[model samples]
Target chain A: MAHSEDVDHTSHGQSMGLLRVLGPAHVWALGVGIVLVGEYMGWNFAVGKGGAYAALIACWFAGVLYSCVAMIDSEVTSTVAAAGGQYTQAKHIIGPLMAFNVGLYLVFAYTMLEAGNAITLGFLVDTVAGMTGHEGGLDQRPFIVLAIMFLAWLNYRGVLATLTFNLVITAIAFSAIIVMFLATSPLLGAGEMLHKDLMSGQASLPYGWLGILAAMHFGLWYYLGIEGTTQAAEEVRSPARSLPFGTLAGIMTLLIAATLTWYVCSGLLPWEYLGDGVNGAVAPLFSAAQISGSNALVWLLGIGTLFATLASANGCINDASRAWFSMGRDHYLPAWFGAVHPVYRTPYRAIIFLVPIALIFALGAPLDQVITFSILSGLLGYTFMPINMIMFRKKWPLDTIKRGYEHPLHPLPAISLMALCSVTYFAVFLGYGTQLIAMIGFYIVVSLWFHFWRYRFVKRADQFTMPWPRPRGY
Target chain B: MMDTWNYIEYGAWALSALFGLLIVIDWIKIDTTYSEEALTSSREGELEAMTEKHRLEG
Candidate 1:
């Protein structure tokens, strides 16, 4: 008799599955962990683009984008119930080529974010070293590599421990925001904030309507990876109920966090200082704490930044590995990557593969540029959402199947997502037009390669993994 | 004469190398132990086969 170590009831050799033990809390943790890091740093870059006022406009506009995405994602993910999230959805809804592109988008988006997170960890350490009397500052290369490896190890062990750790750290990081809000006491309505000065001269409408358009690019930092919750759809115990509940809750939490973050930062610093180039503060929250002259606030926000960074990196490893593993299982990539760890029931190979790739991104790429690449990758994935939702509803009409959650305003969310994505695309184009076109061209070339070469390896009949009936009109 | 921060840097690099080695070792072990067929057979494939059967019967 073959012995088994994981999922006790399943035999050693037959069809082992990922552990299905996650709940709504784990889903929230996964999504929030991947995204909360943005609150600490990147969102302030919107201030760089559009000043304080335009950045606020981008924030709420992005909020609308988040709601639609959450709704559309929850519905499909709950009904489909698989890893690879959008990749799996596209495979079933569209065809293999679209699926291939979506899968690559998911992988790159998270991997880039993971790399950004690791670099931020190194920067945080260097800053701390200087603060603690080490003037020359420690090198960040090893710490960056170490962060990637450590998180990969956590992911390698098992999903349960990894996401549970995410839950604890994500909760603490989020509470730091809450604590900052309370400490700043902006609601006291005294001269605590420069709300009066918000509309002064160029600060409010510096670049005309174009500034608000430009800010939308960095606005994504506020809620970029919340959609990653669905990547863990396969592992959730009750994907139908838990997927929607956890995802909706995650988006709502981020919405509140983003608004408060904008208020706190913009209130404390002048628009110019908050979003400056040569002399700007990199860590906006820490800068705010410094301005406040509160030792307690400084320490809390500092630790919060560290925990949020680690949590984001850890969650990135988890989601990116799942997307890559899902592709491998389907033969879109090498089958060698499809293996799950027999003992840990994790995607060990994919986790290992991403370590060096993310390390290169961390050590080699510039910070703001790497983050923009991440946002663009995410946008590519989101651009597919409207098409995915529309086709999904067409293929499996509401009466045809049991859905965990049906989003109200069926085509409205889908249409809204498309419009917002178009505006954001133009926003990115205003700035990084060359890189944007290059990324799309790269995906197209890869998709062609898959169509001509890799499709033969995938068993056409076997690719339809969901047990649902044949799609309508097929 | 290496300084203190340099040693700390070297130590961190060593720990990272150790982790990488562990991962590579486990990776090679799994590749050698499991058959290509066994490793790639997933829950999704099983479900796909089930659907194929159901479609045939229907």
Candidate 2:
């Protein structure tokens, strides 16, 4: 059987490898930091879609989908043990054409998300300034630019420090959510939250099962980037142990956080206020705090919102640059992007290159459009997993290969993931039919571009680095 | 006192510009100092070349 584990290389010389400074804690921080921002704000938009009940259903549904994803990802990533996450999986399990597409998915998804988080960081600053009854609105551009450039600089310096910083802020943001739930626990006991009243009246599912499906779209916010933990596979001290623990732990954290967020927000906010329109929630948790009449809670939630946004942006920069750097290393893009800083042992060039691209995304696109693009790109990437899993097992059967962490109920997790993805894709279509089509066209064009021109630069035979036996038949 | 936020707004822009400039300078310096192969080639690349012939072709 072919054994798979990350080769821990001791430095023969001073300047050779990515510094394996990360532990499972850093891995958890990267995943949770990127996702806790959702609980602070965007997931509430699902309430706007199908009402509070629908949002709750969607949250749990999303939990199932992402749980399956984390399990399958742990299995594949533990074996692949590379930087690009799903992109690397696609390259080895599938082919170059699929890898190019999946690579674009990770790059675009994380880049757009980074941009969105930076943009939200600016908005958070604006909202805080507005709360103080400031004279005029600050230009969000400078704040957005500052956040992106600063995080990019952090990423360029080193991975260890960047993710350690993420750990601190992500934990703080997560704490605020827990505090919010506890603060409102009294109201729930006193029957003051009006949840029962609202559900009986209008807070019930308006669009029925269709609404729940629609809510699944925004429901994605709960754990959108938890899968990103796998992106740091190469840097982990022990990919075998850390990848499974961090990823599964990250998903579990998100599930708890998502449920608490839904419960608190639904109970606290009025039924009418919960899902006002197709585009819902300016800042739902902050709004919920205001309704609770606790200045302290409001401030805490506001600070939480800001920290979550910053953490998300920081994590996004870390992941996006890694994906881009891995692709460059494989010669999918210019080789310059593959360069590691001889001193810091970070992907300095890719980190710098993605700054302007993220800046463009942050400054130019509308938040809704940016978010939709990111989520759609992510959903498309999720679709590729089942195929990869099936192909992986077929290529190297269980008896022939030694996987680091083999997922149980092999075909079951893959099937559940595909079914969830199909539903989520439908949910996206219900709201963003036109955008969905456009995203497909965008990827199709990029795939063709890579196949025709970029393939020449890619060192095809050298790209397969895994030490495994040949396919069962081939 | 005038709204202090205005100062912060301007400072943010200045800081952003400075960071961008620094990254560019560092990028240029690194480019000048190292050859492309030196930057791109790593222990990982060496491993890829040594093992596992590319089976899943484009």
Highest-scoring model, TM-score = 1
Give one digit per residue, the lDDT tens place, for model 2 in A128-227. 8887887668788999999999898889889999999999999989999888888887744333476787786544877777778788998899999998
Cα displacement (angstroms), candidate 2, residue A15, comes to: 6.6
Task: Give candidate 1 misplaced runs (Cα > 4 Å).
Answer: A1-13, A186-191, B1-7, B45-58
lDDT of 1 by residue, A103-173 (tens): 99999999999999998999988888778767566899998998898888888888999999999999988
What DockQ results do all the predictions give, each relative to the true complex?
A: 0.36, 0.30
Please list the residue runs of candidate 2 whose C-alpha ends up more than 4 Å from where it truly belongs after superposition: A1-15, A187-192, A276-280, B43-58
Docking level of model 2: acceptable
The TM-score values for the models, in the order shown, are 0.94, 0.93
Model 2, B31-53: lDDT tens digits are 77665555665544343333334
- Any residue pairs clashing in model 2, and if so which? none
Docking class of 1: acceptable
